[model samples]
Target chain A: MKDTALLSAPLQVQDLTVSYGGDPVLTGADLTVPEGEMTAIIGPNGAGKSTLLKSALGLVKPLSGTITAWDQPLAAQRDRIAYVPQRASVDWDFPTTVLEVALMGLYRQLGLLRRTRPHHRDKALACLDRVGMSDLADRQIGQLSGGQQQRVFLARALAQEAELYLLDEPFAGVDAATEAAIITVLHGLRDAGKTVLCVHHDLSTVPRYFDHVCLLNRHTVAQGPTATTFTDANLMRTYDGRLPTAA
Target chain B: MSEFIALSLPPMLIGTLAAMACALPGNFLLLRRQSLIGDAISHTVLPGIVVAFLLTGSLAALPMMLGAAAAALLAVVLIELIRRFGRVEPGAAMGVVFTTMFAAGVLLLEQTDTASVHLDVEHALYGNLESLIWLDGFVPGALTDPQALATLPPELTRMALTLAVIALALWIFWRPLALATFDNGFAQSLGLPVTTLSLGLVVCAAMAAVAAFDAVGSIIVIAMFICPPASARLMTNDLKHQIAWSLAFAALSATLGYVLAGYGPLWLGAEASVSAAGMIATVSGLILGGTALAGPHRKA
Candidate 1:
């Protein structure tokens, strides 16, 4: 049973040690994401939540670690995964439209030479519609509000059609409506048998938004289903007894 | 007509072609906020030319261009090394490497006996655009004669070929280029070679700068690489329109600037013409300023 569980896991990171500028950000961290579930990695301000997420996607270099996705190395599983980095990672003033940003999701499939056609446009449009952003398809990315920009990013990731979704704080700095819509889409993805892992803030929403939780403070404090693992004890341990919450 | 073809046609066409070539990759470079890389590459090409002149003991085109290309690549490598190992920011590293290389080139120029050649700091800064005359173009209907074309300045042919290659590369890698420029981290996650693409962009810029350095000066190379694309960036919110606008602005700057430099003084009763390269750079900056004033998407 244990072997079957390991084989079926969507993402597994063992002994990840990452440092930035000679300062260790993550030290001996391990994570195993449950397949087809919404898993949240929550921790305090300096807990390396973002680092762990980026290291999994090969965006951050790991000092000593092995990252596997669906029982294979992360490199081999790149096409099978979609990553939604923080919205602040890109320059909002870049000259691209919403539809164009969404079409970015099809680049790996289009390879280097294949042109985008009508079907690809329709697919990207459908993703925008799923996020209630189909009307803003022609608008420049810089014109969108914070919540709208967050939705546009989610729409792009949805257009990827991947088996695993890794997001970095997708709900941060968004309106309540956008948050609800995003969570609904994420839950739908989980129900459709796609693995969803995200670096989440707002301890108040952990039990409500995520089905599984990994309480992390540099290292994995506890990880399991929300019912058994997201207790007050784990919350205090993750936040260092701060009892902080986000609206 | 013959005078126009022999004297005016070559430089004007060469200036236009060179402008368009640099502006093409300049679109992507501007978007990536690495516009100064063009400045650095153009400056570094100077030392390369001096070195090539030193080694070849002649003003041959091919060897000088090869040397320029090598130096441009070396400048890029040095900047990366400093940024990586020296733990310095990219801007500071670029400033250090390009300036040092350029200063060395100037020193090398002063040290070498180049009295016989048209090589000097002034010539490199303001090119011999007035001297790129095509005497073969003086023959009647020489425009249609293959023999006449054979005697044409090689800089014109080299610039045309360089422009074609840069255009083809941009066309082929449009999507990936846009993705990499917009968000490199996302591109990496998709298994795209973002690093290779970034390096390829620098290589393309270096190629344009080297080719253009022969006819136009470093001033126009750096100016064309930044000004046209930057002006176009304010004109449109779509990448396609941005590229198209940049090319149009580049052509406009080259033609108008070259024409004004060549004849505006003649019309004003002056005996000598001004530097066409400097005029082109001025015109490009003027266009950028115009766009900033009234372009539709000029706001941040």
Candidate 2:
């Protein structure tokens, strides 16, 4: 058949449904994120893009169906996945420094009751160095600008060292140089055979940035190679009922 | 004035130290939005103490404190389960779990028939530092003389030891606590066990609550748990600075409150019934509120 067995998908979400209290944000959404590639999920506001990523990370519980990663269930294999939330979702004013936040990725490995050893601290600094945030390691998170905050989170995800990386809107409020830096980091991860799935908002950069794409509006409109799948028709369906081809 | 000083100064010192210990953990709890869990555990520990008392019929601090910590830890696990599996909101889950546990504790007290043991809900809520002063001293061994010399207040010693243990715990887990409180998801991916850290925090908090129960009483411990850290948060966005400032404020408030409660009655033309514990709480609240209102929007 197509060696589907050997080429196992890193993340497989089947008929996933989620809601806030009662209103359904995603109904029967299905997606598969492959290993060793950069996949971008793009849509307009309220398109359930973030919801899709949240479900995958177990941040939001699915009402039905299941999600699997690397042939194992996502529930039992939490350490194997890393999530980078939207820049605005957290309180920057929280009394923590950049290095401290970056070290959070080491929490799972170090255990809650354990201290971050000199080695772990050194590793966190290394991730920061990769993201060019090593100089700002001791800066209070609240004092950082939006772009710096975004970079800090990326470094945190890097510190996680997970096989599967899920990031949401990392580029929304960042500068172009930071965006380029983030893209470079993601490209490096992809080249190293790690899977990266990012919920992105920039339509113009999709062609240049991502290797794969998932177009979604409640249900997944399309999923495949960016060149073959991000067609005018799919973009129109993702945006709304209005067709870009007819226009 | 000297008599009042002798009666209250020692307890006030112990209470201030206890409050400082509580504030260290409280800073993280407040940021994580788990401040009310302290109030919950403080109340729920009553039944545990009562049970331990009924079993021994002797007032021993160690066993009773262990029993209280165990009970509070159970309450925390239950809250986590309900929040995770039941898909309940955090606030609602906390309210339900704490209230349920508190009610169970009350029922346990009635069943144990130790209502008149004087560790009732009121005393548990509104502590009497006066009582702790008498808890000071060493019991002579059987081989020693029948008439023994008295020692310094054991309450002070216990407070000192408790604070040392708490300080050590914070020092070890400082980074993880900071990370988990700010971003749990990232912490988890990094392989940090946010749950274990949370459990450790609650256990430490429970231990502190039990340690201070004698000096600060259970009720006013909330002031210690929340006030200093809340006030410190207003002044700085740095975690280290918050810990330092909160400790300083806690020590200052305790001294000020102790001095005021002892001497303010002469100026007011009436005997002051307000305890140093209450005065410190009021002062901490005022500082917290003032700072929150006037503090810069830069941090937020």
Candidate 3:
């Protein structure tokens, strides 16, 4: 039993039900994300894609569910998880620099009142370099372009040094170069044997970007390898819209 | 020269310290976009002060401060309750809670024989800085003498100690406070005690409000809690620079306001100066307005 549990998927959610103001957003949602793969959670608007990710991260409490990472409770494995929230969730005009936002990822390790040491700064800079944001480290975050801001958030998540990365709409509103840069980083993370789950919107690039796909609409429609599970039927079922002729 | 020093120095020092105390926490409050909480706390603390006086029959600082802190916390709790259970907007909840509390305080004051207590509604709303006199004659050598410390008015000592405590708290909790204010969701996910830290900040703000209540009045405390920090926020995009600028702006407003209140009347041919607390608030507002106008980072 222990061996099988250890070999189970890196993330598992069973019978998850979540609601806001008594309105059910997701019901009976079950998902399993394998390790060492880039998994994209694809769904239509108001389809509970963000809600699923938030509930899995424990940002939003589910009405009923069991979510485990590596068969352990989220509380026990919190440090091993890194989350990048959507851009709209933050106050862009806040008084902080790109470097400062990236450094916030270290706050969990450094704890309260402790200054960031030299090693932490080196690590943060390296993370910035990873996302091509090293040149603009000292610039104020509010002054950055949308893509640059997204890259900064990626840098901050990189600074977390976690084994699992959860991102929400990382490609939304980003330019082509930023999207490619982010995909390269995701591939690097995947090759490193880390799990990456993203709430992605662009359907045309889903197959090229992700190896695993979870199609959802209020609940899981299908979840498996991208080639096997990302079908037109599943897409139509998830989106409730007519399937496109191409791709 | 001696008489002028005796008359002006104590109030100026008091104003500066009070402004500093209020501004320190004001920075965090402004960043959190909860600046109105300061206004709510200042107004709600009035009933606490009145009830403390009625209970103790003496205008002691410590008990009154404790009462005011409790009342401020109660106001926050009430606002939350209204926001949650009543399903009211946060701003509306704050307005409902603070106005009701302030009215209750006024009713309490009218019902009690507070004349013997040396506290009244007017003094609670707008403090009497003119009466804060250093009765003990100043000795030039008293600056360094330990005995001379005892000669200072209790209000000045209280303000000084409050300023020191506020500064120390900011220095010690700077990281957690900043993280929590900047991104509360991230802070919570990191296992930081975000709620406790927020409560601690609110309590500190309440303490500063209570400490300054006797010298600067609730109105000036409210002004100090919003204006200087807001001006500082407009001037900088770095937290450390913002804090330093906030302190500088606060001190400048206090000193400039005192001088303008005391000396500006002479230029207008009036023999006496107006209220120092009112002037301090005015100067702080002017600074905020000016920074909003000229600040490079001011939003379009």
Q: Which number leads on TM-score? A: 1
Q: Candidate 1 residues B8-55, lDDT tens each?
A: 999888999999999999999999999988998888988899999899
Candidate 3 residue-wise lDDT, A1-247, digit = tens: 1235435667888889999977899999988888889999988888899999988888888999999988898888889988888987788888999988999888777876667888998888899999999999899988999999999989988999899999999999999999999999999999999999999988899989999999999999999889999988888888776554435
DockQ for the candidates, in order = 0.88, 0.41, 0.66
* lDDT, model 1: 0.90
Candidate topping lDDT: 1
Each model's number of backbone clashes? 0, 8, 0
lDDT of 2 by residue, A1-247 (tens): 1348524688888888899867888888877787788899987788899999988877777788688887787766777778898888887878778998888777567764665589998999999999899999999888888889999998988887888889998899898889988899999999999999999888888888888899888888888889998888889888896543331
Give the CA lDDT, 0 to 100, for residue A203 in model 3.
87
**TM-score comparison, 1 vs 3, better candidate:** 1
Off by over 4 Å in 2: A1-6, A14-29, A44-47, A60-68, A72-81, A105-135, A161-163, A191-194, A236-247, B1-10, B43-122, B134-165, B266-274, B286-300
Error of 2 at B202 (Å): 3.2
DockQ of 1: 0.88
Worst 10 residues of 1 chain B by lDDT: B115-124
| Comparison by DockQ, 1 against 2, better one | 1
lDDT score at residue B70, model 1, on the 0-100 scale: 83
Ranking by lDDT: 1, 3, 2
lDDT score at residue B35, model 1, on the 0-100 scale: 95
